[model samples]
Target: MISKRKLYYLLSPSMRYSIRKIYYFPSDFWDLISGKRDKTIPPKGLIFIGPGDFKRIGEHYLNIFKEQCNLLPNHRVLDVGCGIGRIAIPLTNYLNKEGSYEGFDIVKNGIDWCQKNITQKNPNFKFTHIDLKNDLYNLKTEQTANNFVFPYQDSSFDLVVLTSVFTHMMPDDVVNYIKEINRVLKPNGKCLVTFFILNEESKNYMKSNSDFNFQYNFGDYSLMDKDVKEANIAFEEKFIFNCIKENNLTIEKTLYGFWSGRPKNESFDYQDTLILTK
Candidate 1:
């Protein structure tokens, strides 16, 4: 069998990134064939997918944001990597007129959907399409993640969110984004971000059983599939903590996830949740 590292080197970067989509195509095709398609689902080419994932995961994170961070109806919010307005759709009814939402993503289709479907109906909710380069999704963009600055004024938001964002991001980019999140947040503002944290317990759990085990330690992080490094990245817990502290953000709370074989009652979502305050 060809080793993952050898296979990674054999394929071009684009191929390595795009091949993961092939794995999901069958499942996505079944969803379409079964007539389960909806406006919530992005087009097949633009799929960051899972059928019914938008509604289910959105509500799960929203509840955590509300409970742990004291998310208020009137607070200004920012949703980084706000794919297809999963969180924005629910917040449309939850947020009052005084509250406003700003979300940005590299994928044009998701942003366009949010603009037309969510923003047009609710003017306060806004979406921006950022052409940032990502090997897996937006390989054509000239802008790289490390240098891309978030378009927002200082101390602009009371709450900033990054659901499944950092999990795909490289370490430098993650650190840069954390700094931007810190700069834009108001004093005592909170950020709800999710990641696949590789700690002693989670690592041990992964060794025993888990569909996605990040076995390849690629320098700063671990990868489930070495060929597609960004498909699933798990960072060291200490590195993440250092990034938060270096950015001047304080961790308010942490809820471990069930992804590492933890019981459902003991965990939150599939990724570890960190509630950080600026």
Candidate 2:
């Protein structure tokens, strides 16, 4: 069987993008027609592949935060690129009344759903729609990624989490986000981010993997498909480490993931996770 990544390239870039949007149409239609789509449970078509994946990934992140970040019940949390409350739903039960949560994403539909569902009931959980331009997701925007300021006061959040976000972003944009994360983080605050780290080991592993390969080297990072650079971006490990430190965010720990073809026991998730503190 053809791998998903390989199959993704069979169509032109525009076609691929259109197909993805089209793929989600049925789920959106179901929500409109049946009213069966649970607001508590995000529609499976947007960020996740399966219905259970939303809870599964959210709980996994919660566990990681608790274990590595010492996440407390009263800690203020920020979910960057929070897609349809996949992570926020689980966090609602974990955070105490004193704690608050804020989430933002480039997609309007996800943000609208999250606002009506999550923030309406629990006012502490706020969601914002950032109309940032992205080839695959948001196509038009007045604000550029490097210049768009995070809509929060300085030193606001205790913990900031970004899952599967940087994997699709460019290096400069990622650095700008790191700087923003550093700026908004309270003293001793932690930021947990997931990335496709291109170290020597991972680089070698990708060479033999027919499913996905970071073939286009762009100095600081590599892309699986050159035509659609943002589809899957992987940064050089050293470059990312330096970028993080330069942004004043110290790397507390690095947990490698299974996307590099590492043995199941050796990897934690699909994307390598970095725990950072300012």
> Relative to the unseen true structure, what is the C-alpha lDDT of residue 12 in candidate 2, on a scale of 0 to 100?
60
Question: lDDT tens digits, residues 1-278, model 2?
Answer: 86676676556634653575689888778886898776577555554222346677788889989999999999999999887888898899999999999999887778888888788888989999988876456656656687778999999999999988898788878989999999999999999999999888887787678676787888899988776677788999999999999988899999999887876699987889999999
Query: In model 2, what is the error at residue 95, expressed in angstroms?
Result: 1.0
| TM-scores, one per candidate | 0.84, 0.88
Q: Which regions of candidate 1 are displaced past 4 Å?
A: 1-47, 50-52
Best by lDDT: 2
lDDT of 1 at 121: 85
User: TM-score winner among the candidates?
Assistant: 2
Residue 272 lDDT in candidate 1:
95
Estimate candidate 1's RMSD in Å.
4.1
**Residue 138 C-alpha lDDT in model 1:** 70
